[model samples]
Target: MKGLSWLSRLAGGLVRLEGRKFTSLKRCQDDHFLTPSKGESALYIHIPFCRQPCLYCSFHRYQFHEDIARRYFRNLRTEIDLYLDRGFRFAHIYLGGGTPTVMMDELASLLSHLKSRLGGAVISLETNPSDITSKNIALLKELGVGRLSVGVQSFNDRLLKAMGRTSHTGVEAQEKVRLAQGNFETLNIDILYNLPDQPPEVFRNDIAMVRELEVDQVTFYPLMPPLNRGDPLPPSLKPDNRCEGLFYKMILEEMYDGGYQPSTAWCFSRGRMMIDEYIVDYGDYIAVGCGAVGFFGGGLYANTFSLDRYSHMLEKGGLPVALFRGLSRSEASRYRLLTTLFGMGIRGDGFPRRFGDSPSNGIQSLVGLLQFLGVVECDGEELRVTAGGMMVVSRMMREFFSALNRLREYCLRYGI
Candidate 1:
């Protein structure tokens, strides 16, 4: 058993090394599976500036810097030009950030350039409630932004403070939501449950708050433990297993009672609104900015995490891609399985016919075990994760990570 584990790790390491080499030479570009037939694509532009970093955020973000930001935006325009020259047409654009609303003027400029290039696209900008003033909202609407994704991490003031967020109070957040409800075609609010000090009732009330807001969509995500490589356990908040389980249970019960459909594990919709429908459908996206990841063709590429490095690369007429991987057929199939099973809670029968066989035999066996354990159900055509499975999607994803870790260990010990 020990030998086998080592062998798996060795193989995984070799695969990772090969991926690194491929990324270094930008050779992974050939593996992209562009959806030419779709003719439409999604665009994700990462605005890394934030008022302050959240305690639990693992994404690459930095505090506000005007000079640096201006430089970054220039590079961003260059990056967009690269894609425009490639004859890509985008239909949806998402500006995600540390807080996109922080740099309203810059964001508007970026959107203006994109609109001039793409003609028209459904633009969504993620923001915090405090940043969504009347003036900024009007500016966004004028700039052709139709959707707003508010980061209302939690309605609880205590939790909000703990999360290092100071944008708005619960009441203020509600007011912002009200303002955005009619203005934006789609309004998606993000809420987090299972903080270190939160209880089940608190989470229930949070859902009730969402119900009261009557926003188009609500994304309920459990608190993820800090992922900083150095400090495994950050002092701000810790993950509680029991509280997490109860939190999810409460969310499911309340959301269902509120007449929201489980669009995905973390996503719930009240009406027929589809905020991120393109990703679930066969659409393409271009991710630009530091630490932003883009999916094109069958390839996944990420820009440099360092702000300076990313800017320098882009200024030098490079893609700023620090790491990229060409997904093999099997790897792409596994990626789809992971995304679908966890995201939409639905698996397609056409997947197997399109991507060689069903997920690997190993994955099938794991799915069968999960089914027997009552975490999932298989109707032979489509597989669905039960409420229990949804509650532990994080754990299930971790299991895949564990398997990958074992594989990595094996590969490291024995050359693949």
Candidate 2:
């Protein structure tokens, strides 16, 4: 119908009316259920403890205490064992968090276990600006960290203060980057944009800062405030999707002119390097630790958000799985299409090779739909995200994460 065609164009061309239902979860006991596959997958470790919880952060986290953190680390190792015992093998490991470097020894121990077992698997880690110490950097290198991503949302003091991140100054953040730049194979900095009052000029300076630091990679995140129902935040801290799109327009021009390449929809790098996005690189990753999520074997799995629940379940010799849903065949195909296109675009044969069906099987008619709208361009051999399509992908991802953040908000609030 003419009306249906008009609606698809409005929804940005990758619309899914309903998603998978993951209401049921099973107790993860032995390795038999987690059969190994021939494909290589990455293992994601979520460090859920933070020195201070940022007000706008949506990921599940708790304030760090030495005693409790040490216990959490021990449990993390136990969780890793659960996967290994279940016949899973990871060629790469990504450590993400509420500041994975908050406790040095625990981080070191976890890496030690991984190195001994996985045998030179690539390791990646995340940290806050405060953790970028010479000692910490040295330790990270010693631990085989190939990629290090630092979350420096803004170099503007005003924005940093507004975000409740006061531990380090903008100057100190640059100094830390100076120290971290050459130590790892890839050094990536994360910057935030589209704040309540962030001007185009301020964002431009942040990009200049990236070049000045000479960091290998950069990831710009449009502000997606977490879902919360407590005292309201200032209007300045809220998200402006319209404003976000404008900033994204600037990113496309600035980064491209600067000679950076797309590592993902948001990540740009000066040279080839490992990106922090497991989703962009690996289709089927296993996420562990409280509040983490994973996709493997045609199903999506979620770990508990509550520390108490996470620890208790793992200690009882279970996988801490809180939710599980098997994606429909079409859903799986569409997912592959979404993620691949988010990066360098998809090879024409990618869908059929991965999903055993043509792109039309999962994407439905959206192929012709998006191409018709100038959102994407297709050569029979490949489909690539065009300059115009960047904003579309940005909004699409923002909406998806917003929904997930809502779930995180509810779980953390009611202790679900």
Candidate 3:
């Protein structure tokens, strides 16, 4: 554990440094360059309107207003057409947001348009408990949504209140889960851990409830507070990182013992199911909608955070991309390694095939050190993360996302 702590600090520092590169601005020489390669890519669409934004969340979101949301959804379709016109094609689509299901008519319209344009793409959407009604479920299924992920952050009412989530209570969340279950190919429930004053027993009970409910999958996310220098979270609601590993260990032990399997470093499933983290499935993805981010052809770009700016850009017949950064060869290779490992393991020659360079020739020493530390193992050109290494990867991912939250905070603060 001592050694693991040291390693976590080292990995955290490295990821923070790397994440800083994403905050800078650079204009794309040609918007056409942002089009994803044909082979394997996904589309991420963000809806930034929420009824009430959570204090701990750093994603781009705004207070819900019907007229504003309707206009945003219309502009969202236009943005999608922009990508489609750029020759981007995707079979996997993930819709996430402030409350994707908050405006049903707009959502249905957007999905219908997607179906008419990009037929039969498997859609995965995130919703809150309040939106998991039978009507919504039928509408989602009709729209070709195969996976439904609910953001039931915790089933503890006190914890829920502490997190500033008031859409539903613990009992309401459970009932909603039951209501939505068996309606889709995969039913995922999100559970959060390591919140201020949240006890180990509370997390264990939350895991116990997951086993009782028998959902298709559950994603356990560490509480990552916003890093905006303004300190958005009160001290009473802050996340206690020191106890994060303890909660993670409980997750590993409980989930595995309950017949669940690790689909990714943070996601566990009962059997073959659709996982939420699209980066693990698609090598590249195109992000649409305001405040969206995407990676394509070795470059990372973000859409403008201001809804007005986004709409104006689309109105003028241009992409709403506000920031662009092309990663170097080494940085890109290391990124692939990080995400591949986060998905559990890297299998036979994936690196060489994807990057045209062997994994050994890139980030070899980092791999060597992880191997020596028993965090990863090499077997016939494949590398796998050890059980002991889960926490390390968890720490790495937490740091990566925390840095992203920082970027999001900056964008929101300045309306970039």
Q: What is the lDDT of every predicted structure here?
A: 0.68, 0.77, 0.83
Error of 2 at 222 (Å): 1.0
lDDT of 3 by residue, 127-234 (tens): 989988888899999999999999998899998888788989999999999999999999999998888768899999999999999999999999888445465567
Task: List, in order, the clash count of every candidate structure.
Answer: 22, 1, 0
Across 189-257, the per-residue lDDT of candidate 2 in tens digits comes to: 999888887889989998988887778999888788854748688787788665666688788888988
Which ten residues in a row are the worst by lDDT in model 2? 16-25
Q: Pick the candidate with the highest TM-score.
A: 3
Q: Write the per-residue lDDT of candidate 1 for residues 1-416, one digit (tens) a residue.
A: 22223332443354445434333323233323433345777878888888866767645567888898888888888987877776777888888877877777788888899988888788888898888788988999899988789988878888788777776787888888898888988789998776777766777788888998888899876665543434455555776644545566677788888889777767888778464644544424678887676666776666666778778777777677654566665555555655565564455684444344544534567567667756568876577877656655544343443333333333223322
The whole-model C-alpha lDDT of candidate 1 against the native structure comes to 0.68
Give the residue spans of candidate 1 off by over 4 A: 1-38, 227-234, 273-279, 282-284, 345-385, 392-394, 397-416
In model 3, which regions exceed 4 Å deviation?
Answer: 27-30, 227-232, 359-361
Q: Name the regions of candidate 2 deviating beyond 4 angstroms.
A: 1-9, 12-33, 347-349
- Which candidate ranks first by lDDT, i.e. highest? 3
